[model samples]
Target: MSGELRIIPVTGLAEIEEGDDLAELVAAKLELENGDVLVLAQKIVSKSEGRVIALAGIEPSEEAREIAGDDEDPRRIEVILREAARVVRVRPPLVIAETTHGFICASAGVDASNAPEPEMLVLLPHDPDASARRIRDRIRELTGREVAVLVTDSFGRPWRQGTIDVALGASGLEVMRDLRGTRDPVGYELHSTMIAVADEIASAAELVMGKLDGVPAAVVRGLEVAGDGRALDLVIPEERDLFR
Candidate 1:
């Protein structure tokens, strides 16, 4: 960890669309450097990957209709269900589900905000880790700089109010910092201490890329925590999950 860190927001990107070259677009706007951590919002990645869905095209099933009730649109619920592997909890309009990517999030990461059009929804990337890798690889090709890329999304924590940005996908970085055998300053040997470094970096990046700012990307500089790790490294195994 570096004593000085910098989070530079990458702005001026036009509204992303399906089939757009996201890596190229970002590279044109920012001058990236080697060892820089490029943090990207999930919405832009989803948009570029053509993951947006039109509500009018969705046909709600009986289960989706039942879950949506009369207050919410069944079409939206159907989209959420389609992306979710299993429903974790159902409370009226709020559906906590496990996404097919093994992420436990609200509505399986189906979001209506920042959509390209009205009555449309944006879905999480089918393979977020792959998405990150593609962007990272392209950036390297374009700028000849080896920068780490992280796809980030806002997630609500259990028993916590408000949401924080978390790493949905990662490339070229060690997502976790394990200190199991390291000794603390007090000379106490640590047995089980692991830090979610990727998530922390995502949250730090989000401090500059606000929700309404239209800034979808940021570069984290001066962090000496680059290596090989995926966002999956942060996921708790179902067998080890105490809440499940």
Candidate 2:
């Protein structure tokens, strides 16, 4: 841990499109330094990966229509269904699904907000961890500085009311901090103490990049928590999941 930490919001990025060089775009706007953690909103990563879908092109299926009922757009439901690996729970106009990536989230990370145009939806990146690594590597190539990258998305907690940003993917940093077997300040051995460091950084960076702020990236300066870790390390295995 460092004595001081800084979160700097990156601004002035144009609407990202497929094949856009995100690392170049970001490096041009902000000067990155070694050991900095660059947290990027998932939408921009999706957009750059051509993950945007046009609702007009989607046709609602029978199951999708049944889920939509009358309050929601069947087209949107179809998109959600396509992205979901398993539908956990269904309430009209709301769905809790488990994505193919093993992430449990609402609407399977299919969001319509912040889309480039009307009737369009943004999807989660196909492989968020790979996306993070690509950006991190490109940033190093452009700026010659070693840095970490985290791809983040907003998710609602089952017991909580509002949404918070969480790391969907990570590269060049420790995604978790396990304190098991370590002695506490009171000489008590920790048995089950693990921290989702990537998620915490994502949430902190979100403070500067709001949902409607159009800011897609932020730099977290400080913290010597670099390591070779992936976001998949944070996923609870099905056999160990108590909620399932």
Winning candidate number (lDDT): 2
Residue range 108-151, candidate 2, lDDT tens digits? 99999999899999999999999999999999888899999999
The C-alpha local distance difference test score for the whole of candidate 1 amounts to 0.94
lDDT of 1 by residue, 151-196 (tens): 9999997899999999999999999999999998999999999999
Q: Would you estimate the TM-scores of all the predictions?
A: 0.98, 0.98
Q: Could you tell me which 10 consecutive residues in candidate 2 have the lowest summed lDDT?
A: 223-232
Positional deviation of residue 75's Cα in model 2 after best superposition, in angstroms: 0.8
Q: Per-residue lDDT for 55 in model 2?
A: 97
Give candidate 2 misplaced runs (Cα > 4 Å): none
